[model samples]
Target: MQSSAKTIEQYLLELPEERKSVMNKLRNTILENLPNGFKEGIAYGMIGYVVPHSIYPSGYHCDPKIPLPFMSIASQKNFVALYHMGIYSKKELLDWFVSEYPKHCKTKLDMGKSCIRFKKMDDIPFELIAQLTQKVIVEDWISMYESALKR
Candidate 1:
């Protein structure tokens, strides 16, 4: 579900008690692993990491006024979701994540184009997520994003 909260702190406060801890851990994991040049804020009603205008003045092509989104973590109705644009835009990264998922979690991979759903909060693979977060630096992500936009 999309949150109406204006800030990350507010967003966390609004989460159900059951989801607070996991979401916090996920947020921390992403923050610790995310490469430099990405800023953290509330975007699309979730905790988002984006390439800010300071780094990429062109901003998001979809909406030039907004920053270029890289990743986000949200507590959806049925599950917690990690949205990583890299995996959606880069095939090699997707392949690596798919191959590595089984090694980290016993639960079958539950994923969409960019959103990885963790239905079993206990099974959320923070380590794998950390690795995935670190895989793409800002430059690489911008390059990949730009390349995709051309098509």
Candidate 2:
């Protein structure tokens, strides 16, 4: 469910008590592994990590006013969604994650191009998630984003 909450704190407050711990752990993991220059905020009604305009003044090519998104987490109706832009935009990363995730995550994998869905905390591959997040630094991502635009 897309929350109307304006801040990350408010967003978490709106989630059910049962969901809070899982979300908080995921958030902390992301924060701990996130490369420098990614800032967290409420975007599209979910908690988003982005390359701020100060670092990438061009902003998101889809919408320049918005910052360049790197990742996000959302509480959806059926599952928690972890949106990984790197995996979606890069084929090699996606292949690596898909192949490596099952080794760490015991549950059945549920994922789209960018969205990794999990019904519970146990379904999450926290270690792989952290590794994936750490793989791309802000400058590398910006270079990738810019290259894609030229194509």
Candidate 3:
């Protein structure tokens, strides 16, 4: 579910006790592994990691006022979701993640185009998520986003 919390701290505090640790671990995993040049903040009502406007001045095409969103993590009504733009835009990355998922978690991969839904929070694979976080650097994401925009 979308959150009204202003800061990541606030967001975390608002989460149910059951979700707090999991979301924190997931957030920490991403923060620790995310390549430099990406900033963390609340975006689109979730915890977002973005390529800031200072780095890519054009900002997001859909809403130029905001930074270019690369990834976000949200606690939904029934599941915790990790949204990575790279997997949606890069076919190779998608293939890699899909292939690696079963090796990491027993649950079938529950995913949308970019959103990976973790219904069974206990089975969340932090290691695989860390690897995925490191796979795309800010420069590459900017390039991929621009290329798609031109298409």
lDDT of 3 by residue, 115-140 (tens): 99999999999999999999999999
In model 1, residue pairs whose N, Cα or C atoms come closer than 3 Å (at least 3 residues apart or on different chains), thus clashing, are none
After superposition, which runs of candidate 3 have C-alpha atoms over 4 Å from their true positions? none
Could you arrange the candidates by TM-score from highest to lowest? 3, 1, 2
In model 2, which residue pairs have backbone atoms overlapping below 3 Å? Answer: none
User: Per-candidate TM vs. native?
Assistant: 0.99, 0.96, 0.99
lDDT of 2 at 133: 88
Q: Report residue 14 deviation for candidate 1 (angstroms).
A: 0.3
All-Cα superposition RMSD per candidate: 0.5, 1.0, 0.4
Per-residue error for 30 in candidate 1, Å, reads: 0.7
Identify the leading candidate in terms of lDDT: 3
The positional error of residue 110 in candidate 2, measured at the CA in angstroms, is: 0.9
Model 2 stretches astray by more than 4 angstroms: none
